[model samples]
Target: MTHRISCELAEAPLAPGEVAIVGAGPGDPGLLTLRALSLLEQADCLVFDRLVSREVLALASPKARRFYVGKASRCHALTQEQTNALLVRLAGEGRRVVRLKGGDPYIFGRGGEEGEVLIAHGIRFRVVPGITSAQGCAAYGGFPLTHRDHAQSVTFVTGHRKGDGELILDWSALAVPHHTAVFYMGLANAGTISRQLQAHGLPASHPVALVERGTTPEQRRVITCLGELVATIAREGLTPPTLIVVGEVVRLADTLAQPAAQVAILAEGEIRDRVGERVAL
Candidate 1:
């Protein structure tokens, strides 16, 4: 069977000496935007991070120069300042540089800092927004961030504190009723988050969803109450790139979740498959 390619990108090619800070979306290559795809194809150099999926990187031109500058928790391949300087230097070299990030660069991806440096250096730059992890993960995890019966508002916050210190978030505000809170890079600080939220008035039995590798074929959703947030993560051995969604809306996953069987593995002469069901710990 032959498949026809019918995508029509409506953006002009990125000019030389220009930098395009594009979001690669949350782990799924199909979530990439048309402008981002165009920039990837036209870029002379691609600077990507660890969270960017290999599938998305595969969409780039084969001749494009690639730079791996991924920063993991407690480990740094390239410091933020170093990355900023590199973008400046690359644009100075008159290359069409594509600085690709895992999610929307403006939301905790630090695109603003890089844009600041670019402006100071008088380099031409553009930003292409991509679906944030909260949006992508919540959708694939089968939960709505906001619903009339569950949540009237939604907020996204970073759980990575300076030096992994105390997360200085508005716990009182987040504890309000009818609100959905999504925390990025929150798994390590899950204990603190749960404690603070409960102390601030969110009940211990409040619904929570820990979505691991969300929006990808290997996606895993662990449903648990807010009281058991940290314990649930330990029980499941969940890791970074996981998103924490807290709200009454999370309870809806019990009915809305889809199967994460796309990348099942055969182990020990047995096929371990996760059926189309939500796991509650």
Candidate 2:
């Protein structure tokens, strides 16, 4: 059971004052790339968000300077402006900084905004992409974003906004079948999300999956129809780090899953083989 967790691909040199915007992946240390972990090994300063798991943080060098600038709904440890300034300041100090975000940096992780600051300040940076929670959670929750028979395309959207602003999503359009919707940073809007979808012509019985802290030991998944999702999550008392998925694909978890105890063994062998073959299409 001694699987190699990391590789020798990156122990290379950095371009002196380079600052890399790396994703920590969806709260799973195993999903991190060799390059990312290697960078963390040498990072002089580590700036991470609250969504970054402590497990991943432990992998950084003991000498690294840790800065927790975590941000999310209900908790904004650092303002957007502050984060931008922090990145510029960190780079100015000639520190090898790693901006670790949960999930993919490019997927609603506000990475573009930070990149803009780096460009303005003439800081050399590279983006190391990681798995977004939507994609990660879907796979772990046994729901594919797109199954040939279930969907042709998948769209990821944020269901809520700052300042309690009304959602600007085109509900009538979004409610249509055949397209899967993945919502990130949407824990507080479960009720509204469900009601809006229903008002917009989506059937009340449309399948939905809510995955909390997905891909980790504490992961919780609720499979329900559109009619009861909001109420169900409330009843179950699930908290943040939740991702919502709506589509026929949510109905496939049981069908896609093997018996409970065989998952790890399956993941090491037949599961990947079968999925790899199927994915080749």
Candidate 3:
């Protein structure tokens, strides 16, 4: 049997004079939200980063024009001024623009800066939340952000700074109680992080999880403790675009790794009394 190619995009529609900063969701095309897909479908022009997956780009309507602003790991990204100007110019031409990023737009993705520019220009814009690498990586790597008995609160932080010269993270603060702590773009600083966190009182043996490539088929997850995490990642040859998670919840990640299973158990065990059959297994 032969399958026919449909030029139709599975994206959604958009209104005129509006800009959508969409999260492409940690390199997995399926993680695209319905609203995000809609904006892509109706987008007259898409300003995307070089790191965006081809699969996600392919979802934009066939008629929509695609522009690459070229922001990749260790590569040249357009100046912030130029990028913001491009967005304004595109919208000035009455094009429905989609600023698509590799993961969630807000989580270290620079969507806030773009939003500031839009506000200054009085351009209408919307925010579309997508699965950040933290969520995506943790899910695909079998690490749960929270475990009932293990953790209660989760924190997300960036490991590197664009302008800062050194590892300037607040080590003392991060060493506090947490169910999980996720560090984005942190693979390169894994060693420094380990040393600093340990120096700040975080146990050297605290479990650390490094998820590379996140939700993609090429994804890899390394489960190790802080003391050995650096050596383990180096010996194993993992690359950037990775997330680092540290905490007690990681110890129970094996059991809560299943999305459907976690939901089911939460429903049947915890919410049964208050939510009744609504949460019934």
Tell me, what's the RMSD of every candidate?
Answer: 3.9, 6.2, 8.9
Model 3, span 96-213: residue lDDT tens: 8999988888988899999999999999898888888888777766667887766688888988766557878778878866657888877878888899888988888898887777
Q: What TM-score goes with each of the models?
A: 0.90, 0.87, 0.83
Taking the tens digit of each residue's C-alpha lDDT, what string does model 1 give over 1-281? 52223224665568889999999999777788877887888889999988999888988889999999999887988999999889999999999999999989999999999999999999999999999999988887778999999999999999888894678998999998899999999888999999999999999999888888876666777778889888788877788888999999987875775444222211112211122344331
In model 1, state the lDDT of residue 18. 95
Relative to the true structure, candidate 3 reaches a TM of 0.83
Candidate 1 Cα errors over 4 Å, as ranges: 1-10, 258-281
Task: Between candidates 2 and 3, name the one with more favorable TM-score.
Answer: 2
Task: List, residue by residue over 87-193, the lDDT tens digit for candidate 2.
Answer: 88988888888899998889888899899889988998988898889987888777789988988888899877768688778787678888899989777888888
Q: Which ten residues in a row have the lowest lDDT in candidate 2?
A: 272-281
Among all windows of 10 consecutive residues in model 3, the one with the lowest summed lDDT is 271-280
